[model samples]
Target: MHSKTYILISFHTAELGNPDIVFLISIVLAFTFIMFLTCEILLQGSLRDHSEPNDEYVIPHGDWFEIVSSPHYLAEIVIYAGLVVASGGTDLTIWLLFGFVVSNLVLAAAETHRWYLQKFESYPKKRLAIIPFAY
Candidate 1:
């Protein structure tokens, strides 16, 4: 996703040299880059990845399951949004926008549903999937 954003930025600015659009694209790219970096360090993987097979689920243990499970989806949206804003009113921009939204929605919904199934028997019965109460 990050590579794709970089590709779009390079191609568009090289071919068209639109300063204003390039500036906006640069802003989005910077923000998304920061987000990815932060997520990389802060995001804890699944409990099984961090712990022994015989270990029990507990306070900090559950936290290891997912700091934020849908990060890749989030990155995809940011990349496509950056592309759309960079391309302005082009057909590619519009199609990318639609595809991003639809794909994110589908993936987020499926992940949330899968999360519920996996965590149903866990201690944190109150923990809602995905977007807190909104999910």
Candidate 2:
């Protein structure tokens, strides 16, 4: 592999100690996370005008929604995953928050996915409920 040179921004603090490789990796991962969030938001915004005030909005369709029932929830998980990495993945607080978030979103997506199937007979079978293939 061809390695590129980089700069380090370190602060030796008594409480938190010094920044290291994981922190830097997390910073890069943050960019990926924000992109996911931005896409999810913009996509949902495009669909919002077409799907409100009617009961039809319960079942999201088109784009990422076409593939998974709740893409925004997926995005939220990804954003939190980025944070988990940013925190070096050992923070119990972040892990618990991530767990709760995943659980809640999964439940909601399951309900929404069921609704989509019930509401639209033509809802894609290949598409998942949430969390891609696992869900």
Model 2 residue 96 distance off true place after TM-score fit, in angstroms: 0.7
lDDT (Cα, 0-100) at 134 in candidate 2: 75
Error of 2 at 70 (Å): 0.7
- In angstroms, the error of model 1 at 128 is 5.5
Query: In angstroms, how far off is 102's CA in candidate 1?
Result: 3.6
Task: Locate the minimum summed-lDDT window of 10 residues in model 1.
Answer: 58-67
Q: Compute the lDDT of residue 4 as modeled in candidate 1.
A: 100
Task: Judge candidate 2 at residue 47 and give its lDDT.
Answer: 68
All models, RMSD in angstroms: 6.9, 5.9
Model 1 deviation from the true structure expressed as Cα RMSD, one decimal place: 6.9
Deviation in angstroms for 52 in model 2? 11
lDDT (C-alpha, whole model) for all candidates = 0.56, 0.71
Candidate number with greatest TM-score: 2
Report the lDDT tens digits of candidate 2 across residue range 1-135: 122223233332222454566456557587757768766675766567563376545445566776787787788777777777667667999999999999998999899888878888887887888877778
